[model samples]
Target chain A: MIPFEHIMILSAAIFLLGLIGLFVRKDALTLLVCMGLLIMAVGVLWIAVAKSFGEMLGQGVVLAIIATAFVQGCVGVMLILKLQVHKPSLQVKQFTELKG
Target chain B: MRVELFYLIAILCLFFSLGAVFSTKVVTSLFCFLGCVLTVTLLFVLLQASAIAVIYMLLFCLLVSIYWVTAIVFLPKPNKNAYSKHFLHVGVFLLLGGWLLFVLLPFLQVPAFSPAEIDHGFGSARHLVNVLFGPLRHLWYALLALILAFLISVPVLIRDNTKCGDLS
Candidate 1:
């Protein structure tokens, strides 16, 4: 039987992966994916906490996660489009064109 | 029964999120992202947050999916020469993995079921709202306003300026 703590730990690991990607990656889209990872970790935490509380609040937590994910997805797509058009590539270094 | 199913769904979500992150192609990323969103919505359902779950499925999945498709369709594709080398990426991955393992090892050793029990009453949305609006009200409003400002400014700042780029 999988323990609830196991699930939380796994989520935390996934979150760390995303964090590594966010900090180490040079691509704009990859960073966005990392952001998604961070949000996913929070979603998992909220769900787990809701279940443990036995408050039937899982739905509320999920709703919030979905809402947040939608917003992130919209912004991610727009950023990728803008990056591709301006830099002709996805690498973050190319975006340095805006630098002083 | 439900817990096992939730774990399975969570694993699937992780897979799609990986796909979304690792794919070099633009359209593939969008599809993977869609998968990730749907998986999380299911997770929301498992947790019993129905109202939030519906909004997530409709507003997040449907609405954002359309916008993502539109954005990718209009965006220019880069030359294949832009791809990064593989060995450097592998090294970075290994280093990050090592660091993460070190950090998580201590935390993972402790059991989650500690002495304190989670209070069901104060965990609801009502309590959350009260806590946010009562003591944390100004901070919350400030954050919303800042996000709004960012939404308004980012497009103007990051507009396509490269004439040599593809037309898509």
Candidate 2:
């Protein structure tokens, strides 16, 4: 089995990648994809801790997260589609109507 | 072998994740996301959560299908600027966060570091079902209801937005 520290490092690294992408990317789909990466990282952290304690709660939480991700993904797609209808650019900055 | 597999999966997962965030073509990015999720499922399996891995694979199929069909079929090609030139902004956040992590890592108290002995059924489907229907019944069941609530709310939200004629 892999050491727990390795899992921790992987999760943290992935989370950092996602965070950087979220801040630095412009396309709406890529931003949402970055969010997915962040969610995956958190799920990994949860599972790692749960596995350490031999508890099933981690996996259960991950399941709930998967459900949440699906719903959010659908909603994201819907919003993206709607945004496209009004302004056709994938650049998030173009949809500045939401901005104050 | 397991350790090697873990490292390999970790690298592939990260690479695909990067691709998902940086690929200019929206369809390719969606494919990269699918690859990243699949690699994560492999990581889950390697972590001895085969049950979660299986369920994850099924859900991921559903999720990726939505992304692929919508992004590839419905949407036009995204602009080539998949990445932004906001380096100064990104750098400030990264530097501050990194400094905080550096300053705090030494003081983090990770007590009792030894992992417990795991059983064969530790994260098995049977184990999950038992726990979901048993001790964790309330939490997981509530989660199901929460998902259902989201399912119900999204359509209503879109309809409301359409009728109100404003982006509230």
DockQ of each: 0.24, 0.56
Best by lDDT: 2
For candidate 2, what is the total of clashing residue pairs?
A: 0
lDDT of 1 by residue, A1-100 (tens): 3467966876786687677767766766556666777777777777667667764445355555657776776776676676666656666776766542
C-alpha displacement of A68 in model 2, angstroms? 0.8
Give the alpha carbon lDDT tens digit for every residue of B35-86 in model 1. Answer: 6766776565455443344455567445434544453454555622222222
Residue-level error in angstroms, candidate 2, position A49: 1.1
Off by over 4 Å in 2: B73-120, B140-168
Native-referenced DockQ of model 1:
0.24
Kept native contacts, fraction for each prediction = 0.30, 0.66
lDDT tens readout by residue for model 2, A3-90: 9999999999889989998998998878888888898998888888888888887888898898898789889988888776777767
